[model samples]
Target: MKSSNLLGYAMALIGASFFSLKAVLVKLAYLPSEGANVVLAQNELEPITLLALRMGFSVPAYILIGFWAWRKLADKPSFLPVVQAFALGILGYYLCALLDFTGLLYITAQLERILLFTYPIFVVIIGTMFFGGKITRWSVLAILLAYAGIGVIFAGGEIATGANVMLGSVLIIFTAFLFAMFQLFAKGLINQMGSWVFTCTAMTGAAVSILLHFTISASMGEGVAASLDLPPRVIFIGAAIAFFSTIIPSFLVNIAIDKIGSQTTAVLAMIGPITTIIAAIILLGEPFGWVDALGTAITISGIALYTFFERRSQPIRAIPLKT
Candidate 1:
């Protein structure tokens, strides 16, 4: 492969690895620390509170980057596209993140990552149903394979027995749908304003929305203030989520797409679920039985097949950078 392609692949791999860490970190943040007499243990921090922290630390960087991109623009984009980008950002990041974080409370991080990884299948389904896109036989087969993997996992009985696992799985499935919609709708805006500018703008919008959410919840006496008074280790984990998972991967994936095309970048991103599985096992002591292994393999293979066939039939388009 060319040097650019090689670099792009490297970026994608690294970005996916970083992105995979988000689930593990969130899980870590949820676990109560043993014998730590801190003001607030990890379990005390709610999803909204954690989301607020993640966005709070990351937004300033996004604003600075957006401003830089805006300054570098040869021509100023219209206000309408900017507004639309903001709305899409709320849908994609703010709402999607809220649901994801909440779902993680009820499910294992490994399962959460696997479910989220199925977003592409939702993309294909949504595209066919609403966007006048045609579904070939390969698409149908891909869908079956992906869902079959999910079914296999459910069949394992371990996940089924977990309290609210179904609820968590449903929430994540919806999150996947919203993310797919964001990917489809945000393409035009990304074209209108360049990728970096569009991304930063969207992320800033998400950050603002999350802060507002936290503010509202705090006013309602949800212990939001107490959650913010985190221990050093939790604070560090939050920062890692913001910088390592959200900001860095966002830029890396974008750069990868620019270099090697979204199709290739996406293929490289298959590393994400695998990374999450390993991290969950090592960090969270999550079980990874044969059933989990088989399901994950099936799900990934299905998505990969779908991507390959989708690229063959359609022209390459930009993959939306997800936080």
Candidate 2:
């Protein structure tokens, strides 16, 4: 491989690893703090609050980088693209994130990641159903394998984790659906505005939405000051999430796409769920039985097969930027 290709592969691998860590970090933030100076039970930290903190720490960098990206463009993009990007951002990042975070509270991190991994499958289904995109035998087989894997994990999860797991799984499935929609609609805007400009705009919009949500909720209940008075450990975890999971991986994945093309970068990103599974096992002491292993392998295999067929059938498009 050339030096650039090597760098792109490395970036993709590292980016996927970082992105995989978000679930682990979110779970950690949910754990109760042990120190004497505990301001609030860590478990009391709401999903919206954590989401606010994450966007708070990361949005500044998005703005700065976005400004640079805008400056680099020879011709300015239209205002309509910016508005459209913002709407897509709200769909992809804000709403999807709210569902994912709340769902994580109920499900194991491993299960959450596995369920979310099925978004690409949704993309194919949505494309064919609504966009008149052609679906082949390979697509059918891939969907079967993927859902079979989901059924395996979902059945096992219910027995092990209880009824709440079903609710969480449903929420995450909806999140995946919304994300698939976001990816489908975002391509034109990304092409017009460029990835960096579009991403920054979308993320900024999500950040604003999160902040407004936190403000309204906090004022109505605990008051804004009280909500912001998080314990030091919780604050640290939020910062760590912002840096390791959000900011770094966002830039790395985009750069990787530029260097290696989205198809190749995407194949490399298949490592994300495996990374999450291992991290959940080690860090959160989440259960990972034979069933989980088997299901995960099948799910990944299905997605990989889908990617292979999709790559052959269609021209390459940029992968959706993760929020």
Candidate 3:
């Protein structure tokens, strides 16, 4: 590989590593503790509250990014892409993020990462179902592989019997589906407005949506002020999640895509679940059973296979083999 291609690979792996830390940090934030410290002994924080904090910390960056990108354009900005980006932002980041964050409260971080990583499969399924996309034999095999992996994971432990875990799993699955839908809807917009611009603007919209949602929910009744007034430690964790997990990884993944191509960056991101599992084990004292190992291995293998075949079946874009 060329030097730039090597850089892209490095960036992808680093970004995946950072992204994997998100769930771990969010899991940490749910506890009441001092700065940068998490105490799992007591689970005191709510998911929406954590989500709102993340958005609150990250919103200014998104707004600045969007405006900076806006000002850089030689021609006046086209209104269509901005409008689409904001709408998609609400759908994906605002709604899906809320669900994902809430789901983490009930499920293990390991399971949450694995489930969330299945958004690409969801994208393909949604494409075949609603759009004119073809479903190949490999696609069928891919679907089977994914569900089988999930089944193994489910059978491995209490996720099968625990009602709360099952509900969280369902919510996360929906989060993945919603994100896939956002990807489908914004495909053209990405090509049109460029990745950074579209991403920043959409995320800005999501941030605004989250703030409004939090304010409204806070006004609705009791326990509102209590939840909103989180401790300094929780807020610190939220900032960590925002910058290290969300904003930085988001941009790095895009840069990696630009350098080495999206398919390659995505394939490399198979590291996400493994890293999350390790992080959860080390950081949160989560169990690491043989079943977890087997299930995660199968899950990653299936996703890699699915990505490979899908790439083969689709027409090649002009993405250079080397940057």
The residue pairs found clashing in candidate 1 are none
Candidate 1 per-residue lDDT over residues 104-204, each given as its tens digit: 88899988888898888778778888877788899889889998998899999344348689998999889988898888898778888988999999998
Superior by TM-score: candidate 1 or candidate 3: 1
In model 3, the worst 10-residue window by lDDT is: 314-323
What would the per-residue lDDT of candidate 3 be over residues 1-323, giving only the tens digit for each residue? Answer: 69999999988988888888988898887755655343333445656677788888888887898788778866644887788889989997889988888888888888888888777777787887886677778776877787778889788643333548888899999988888888878877878888888889888888888888877777775556655666677778988988988888887888899999888887888888888888988989888777767777777777777788867987221121110
Q: For model 3, what is the error of residue 67's alpha carbon versus the real structure, in angstroms, after optimal superposition?
A: 1.8
How does candidate 1 score on lDDT?
0.85
lDDT of 2 at 288: 84
Candidate 3 lDDT score at position 124: 80
Candidate 2, position 191, lDDT: 85
Instruction: Give TM per candidate.
Output: 0.95, 0.96, 0.91
The per-model lDDT (C-alpha) reads 0.85, 0.86, 0.78
Off by over 4 Å in 2: 39-43, 157-160, 315-321
